[model samples]
Target: MATTSESEPTTVETPGSDDQSREGEIFDLLSNQRRRYAIHYCKREDDPVTLGELAEHVAAWELDKEVAAITSAERKRVYTSLQQTHLPTLERADMIEFDDRTIELTDEAAELDVYLDVVPADSIPWGTYYLGLAAVGSVVMAGLWLEIVPTEAVPELGWATLVFALFAVSAVVHVVQNRRMRLGEMERPP
Candidate 1:
């Protein structure tokens, strides 16, 4: 065994520590709506965006107004917050490159695309929709098993095929919608 001095420090690398840390950082960055909007704007732009332009659009989005209609005070408030807090945080996370008032997304920002699915407040979650579909299928199967409907009208194989088709169609639509909802995938942020 090697002798160790009390003053020496040992660093151990734990499996998945980097992943866990990265996940933590991502969640923390996304916790704020302003940061989310900033990321959204960056993703939508092919070229690096000036901080002033970022602030104007963010203010417009937050205020639910056109960019020209946004008051100076509103723009200033969002600008200060992003400059002092959100942008720096994003820069440190390596999700964005910030330099000399210009902002651009890094490769890590693309990784965040999967997490940016925007589910509207009024819409049902995908999980609930799938559950309802399953329940309806089960009920129909039960009815068929009980012979409530004539087998002459629809055979067991036909019912099974119809159910399978329904699920397959719904899954395809769900995937398409999810892709549309991801950041930068659409003309507007979802």
Candidate 2:
């Protein structure tokens, strides 16, 4: 009979064991701008998109030009990169179904939206905004507790209600904005 000591480590496989690794893989796949653009394009389409069309749109976005304005050279560079590198990576990850000419998103591709929260360069992140709001609320509560003249003008219950209202409104707006920021949620990629 084989015996194991208490000091020995054992491994147990759980149904959700792969979730963390899968999330990491998803993040890695989305880290590239071209891959994200390709995924966004496929996501917006109800059917598969041709490789040429995907490459043209991606190149145009990268160049900040219209698809019609994209130079053949620019399109070709993006086409080659997607064909040789990005597409295969995404396909292997099961995020997209890619053939020689066309690409379509798989069910797994939709899962990526949960991880995509697009924040513009000039905008603050939702987490930061919430943190700031919480800080302000705390300061206000402190003032009320200390019976500061302005804060004391309102009853404690009224102040509490006001604070709750602010957070409630902020949360609702956050949810709406977050949904809009998700990949493929808007006319353009978030």
Once model 1 is optimally superposed onto the true structure by TM-score, how far is the C-alpha of residue 155 displaced, in angstroms?
Answer: 1.3
For model 1, residues 32-146, the per-residue Cα lDDT tens digits are 8889889888888867999999999999888888899988899989999999999999999999999859999998898997666568788888888899999989987998989
How many backbone clashes does every candidate have?
Answer: 0, 0
Off by over 4 Å in 1: 1-14, 142-149
RMSD of each candidate relative to the true structure = 2.5, 3.7
Write down the lDDT of every candidate, Cα atoms only. Answer: 0.87, 0.87
Error of 1 at 58 (Å): 0.4
**Candidate 2 to truth, TM:** 0.86
Error of 2 at 71 (Å): 1.2
What's the CA error at residue 130 for candidate 2, in Å? 1.0
Model 2, 107-165: lDDT tens digits are 98988878877887888988898899899889888987777737446788887898889
In model 1, residue pairs whose N, Cα or C atoms come closer than 3 Å (at least 3 residues apart or on different chains), thus clashing, are none
Give the per-residue Cα lDDT of candidate 1 at 11.
71
